[model samples]
Target: MIKNYRMVLEYDGSRYDGWQKQGNTEQTIQGKIEQVLERMTGQAVEVHGSGRTDAGVHALAQVANFHMDGKMASKEIQEYLNQYLPEDIRVITLEPAKERFHSRLNAQEKTYLYRIEMGERKQVFERKYIYGLYKSLNVEAMERASAYLTGEHDFKSFCSNRKMKKSTVRVLKEIEFEQQGSRLLIRYTGNGFLYNMVRIITGTLIEVGLGQRKAEDMKGILEAKDRNQAGFTAPPEGLFLEQVRYNV
Candidate 1:
């Protein structure tokens, strides 16, 4: 009998193509996990994720589900998968999930973090995970700008040009900007996000920080509902899928 299980995953996306499996692409987090599953169970398995993160984007807590015929405990599967998976990808934990539990459908909230380094000298060790901007940023201005993004809004202006079937409306529960030493962190938690929403928001916040845009301009941008009204999409390297929350 096939049993459904949920797994928590973490990966350093620097070397990954992305989280989803594309035709003929072997360098994705999903493909890698599927390969390991096939090896362990000797059967094909389809893993469903909460969402697909873009290439070069890291994840601290990504949730996925799959069905398998194995009888091994969740802990055993976790240990075995970690041993075979590449260093960049790790299976953090596993749990038995209801057969009807769908990772994407069950997810209630997601939090993302974008890291920027505001300084002349970039840390060599952390360059792979952060975006370095030499210009001084106005954190106070960015914070005020971010506040405009909180609450329900039509975020079409912040989304990418890619076609999406779902509604563009989203509820942003929290948006904050903080500076720790040389790193600037932009954190956001929302019920859901449109394609490239976080990246675009980060870009707009950067523009506000640079004094090129005013905090009040965000209202006009959202009202415009045009993608061009928002700032450029921030780099994927600085973005992370921080957490996924699900209703039990």
Candidate 2:
């Protein structure tokens, strides 16, 4: 009997090439997990992630699933995988999932966080994870600009034009910015996001904060729906997939 298992994972993306398995290259998070599973079960297995995090993007709770004929207890499977997998990747939770549950398709909501440090002194320990900016930003203007980004809208202006598989209309549920001295944290909760959406949004807001653009300009950018209308995409290291919510 084939049994499906769900896993909640956390990983530091500094040394890995995102979550998807690339052709034969073992540097990806998915590739590392698949290799360890293949070695443990002595059969080729595939793991599906909730979503693809770009290279250098971190994850706090990435969901994934795999099916196997061998029936092992959830604890045993978790322990076995963790024992062999690299130190950076960790399986935080494991359990049986409904046979039809898909990590990506069944997801209801996703949360992402972008970290920025604005000061003369670089964040010594968090230099790799957070973005460092030297200039002071007008936080109130950025917050005013964020209000325009909420609600359902075509976000093509904020997404990468490289390759898009579906419609760019997405519901941006909420955007919150928290400030603590020289550190700023931007959190996004949404139904879905297009390629490079969060990063682009951050860049546009930063432009507003810099007095380069007015807060009301966000409406024009959204209406334009042209990638060229948006600001630059932020660095990958500042992004983190915080959670994936499911109905089940």
TM-score of 1: 0.96
- Per-candidate local distance difference test: 0.91, 0.92
Worst 10 residues of 1 by lDDT: 159-168
Q: Over the stretch 45-158, how does candidate 2's per-residue lDDT look in tens digits?
A: 899999999889999999999998747789999999999999989999999999999999999999999988888867688888998876788999999999999999999899
List clashing residue pairs in candidate 2. none
> Each prediction's TM-score against the native?
0.96, 0.96
Error of 1 at 4 (Å): 1.1
For model 1, residues 26-131, the per-residue Cα lDDT tens digits are 8999999999999999888899999999889999999999999858988888998899999999888899999899989999999999999888967888888998
Model 1 score (lDDT):
0.91
TM-score of 2: 0.96
Q: List runs of model 2 lying over 4 Å from the truth.
A: 162-165
